[model samples]
Target: MATPYIRMNGAGNDFVVVNALETAFRPTQEQARTLGNKATGPGFDQIIGIEPSDGADAFMRVWNSDGGMVETCGNALRCVGWLLLQSTGRDAVTIDTLGGLTTARRAGPDQVTVDMGRPRLRWDEIPLAEEMQTYGIELQVGPIDDPVVHTPGAVSMGNPHVVFFTDRLDDGFVRGTGSLIEHHPLFPEGVNVGFAHVLAPDRIRLRVWERGAGLTKACGTGACAALVAATRRGLTGRRATVEVDGGELQIDWDQATDHVLMTGPVETEGTGTLSL
Candidate 1:
């Protein structure tokens, strides 16, 4: 039998969403990889599973195309929210992930706003091996002497991220630098690496090499993490526009609520069914 699935994109990070609520089959890493293989399978950056929630609104599970289980995915969550609205006919939807509970609201027909919760900045919270107070610390990667770009602001949006600020938006350093930093010893569990260029007090351009997913078109949580890091380092303000390869996202760090809000567009590509 074929299991029905939905294809969607948040910003430009594409995903394959499976409705696990009515299915008994749980996709394994191998299965997910087979489904996400661009050349031979379903083809997607990540595979998302929607299951019934215990106490929260809904339960979500994320799997990278490489077959690694991840804690969260902001963009996919928005797509999940849209699916929930379609199923329940509700404007506001709450979904639970291994990271935590996330709330999403439909702003327009295709626009969704998500409250991704507060960021974790402490070295331990960011889960660094050691303690560091300053936003910019010292670390070395390859032969890039005087790598002044080290010691980035670290944060967790239910996932780990290290953000480095640069002067130019299109600097080619991100691919090489980001690859090395993603596996730096400092992050025992590894981390997603983001290179950002501040275009204005309220705008920034970013590129990301995700921990398990490698480079993606866009990463919603990554944008939030970058904004938080930029604000902490005084590189940008509390709210800003994050331009990723795929599209732009509006991010706001609410002072009163102490949470991060990410607003962006989501598109439904097509729907299909999977056989377990």
Candidate 2:
């Protein structure tokens, strides 16, 4: 039998979502790759499996195109929220994942706002091998003396990230160095790398090199993670506009709630059925 799936995009980062609330089939790593293959199969950056939640509203399993299981995926979660709203007729939905619980609410006709929760900032939480006094402390990478951009603020949004602040978005050194820092030995579990240029007190231009997905058009959790890092480092305010390659996202670090709220748009890029 063929399995039905929905193709969706949040801030331009695409995904394939499968509802397994009633089924027991869990796609293997190889199966996930086959489903994500653009040439011969359904193309997507990640594949999301939605199962019954133990305590929360639902449970999500995320897999990158390369067949690697990921702890969290912000863009995919927004897509899940859309699906949940359609299926349950509820404006608010809570999703449980390996990372933590994420709450989503309908913000507009086609937009969803998610509370991504607090970011983990300690070196141990980021799970880095060594301890750094502060997340903004500098680190060396490769043989490039006077390294391109150091002193990045590290945070974990269920996954690890390093946010490097720059004066200009078009700086020449980010691309090469981003890859280097992503695999650097300092981060034992590897990390998603972000290059951010603060355009204003409440706006930033950002680019990301994901841990397992490489350079994607946009990343929802990355934006939230970056905002947390920037605010902690005094580079920007609690609320800011993060501009990615595909589009923009409004991120607010609500102090009262102690959660990161990410508001963004999602698109339906048609649907397909896959036979495994």
Candidate 3:
């Protein structure tokens, strides 16, 4: 039997969602490569699998376009949360992932808010090669004396991320510099690189180079990380509107709960049956 799939995008980060509850489907590395290719398949930054869960409403599994499985994806979770909400018509839904359990609820039409959980700030959590203050790690690009980018804030939103505060979002700079930092010796387990241009105390312009997905339209965790980093640096308040290449995401780092709340929109581009 063919596998049914939903093509969805959260703030322009596209994904191919497979409801494993309805049809059991898991893609191999080769299959993921083919399916993620815009030429060969529906094309996506990541493919999400929604499976049954005993602890939560559903278990979400994520795979990058390169077929590398990841711990979690914030945007993908929002998409899955929307699916569960539609299916069960519940005010809120809890989804379990390799990272942990998170809850999502409706904020407005097509808008979903996800509790991204508290970020891991310890150096070991990010698993840097050596111990150092994650608030600002010593790394640089360009030249030794005059580096283009330096002192990035490191954190983990289920996955490692290094956020650099910048004044601009140059495509070439983001791709070239991000690719360099992603595999830097400091980050033991690869990392997602974020370039953020703070617009105000409550707004920021951002871009991200995902670990396996390269440059994407938007990164949910990257936005959350940026806010956390900015707040730590006193650049922004606890809450802010992060603007990405795709759209805007409202991120709030609740002081009381210490959990990052991400509010964004999810879109259903199309649906199809996959021949697996």
The order by descending lDDT is 3, 1, 2
Relative to the unseen true structure, what is the C-alpha lDDT of residue 209 in candidate 2, on a scale of 0 to 100?
83
List model 2 lDDT by residue over 97-144, tens digit each: 999998989999889998899878888998788888546855754456
TM-score, prediction 1: 0.94
Candidates 1 and 3 compared: the better one by TM-score is 3
Task: Report the C-alpha lDDT of model 1 over 1-276, residue by residue, as the tens digit.
Answer: 888888999999989998888775477888887877877688889889898888767899999988889999989988998888778888899999988999999978788999999898788887788888636655654457765476677889999888878754453566667777877888887888888888899999998888877788999999999999899988889999999998999999999999999999899999988765
Q: How do the residues 1-276 of candidate 3 rate in per-residue lDDT, one tens digit apiece? A: 678889999999999999898666778988888888888888899999999999999999998988888889999999999999999999899999988899999999999999999999999998799999998998888799998888989989988999999985889999999998889888878999999999999999999999989999999999999999999999999999999999999999999999999999999999997665
Task: Give the residue spans of candidate 1 off by over 4 A.
Answer: 142-145, 167-172
Better of 1 and 2 by lDDT: 1
Question: How do all the candidates rank in terms of TM-score, highest first?
Answer: 3, 1, 2
- Deviating ranges (above 4 Å) for candidate 2: 141-145, 167-175
Cα-based lDDT at residue 39, candidate 1: 72
TM-score for every candidate vs. truth? 0.94, 0.93, 0.98
Candidate 2 or 3, higher TM-score?
A: 3
lDDT values of the candidates? 0.86, 0.85, 0.93
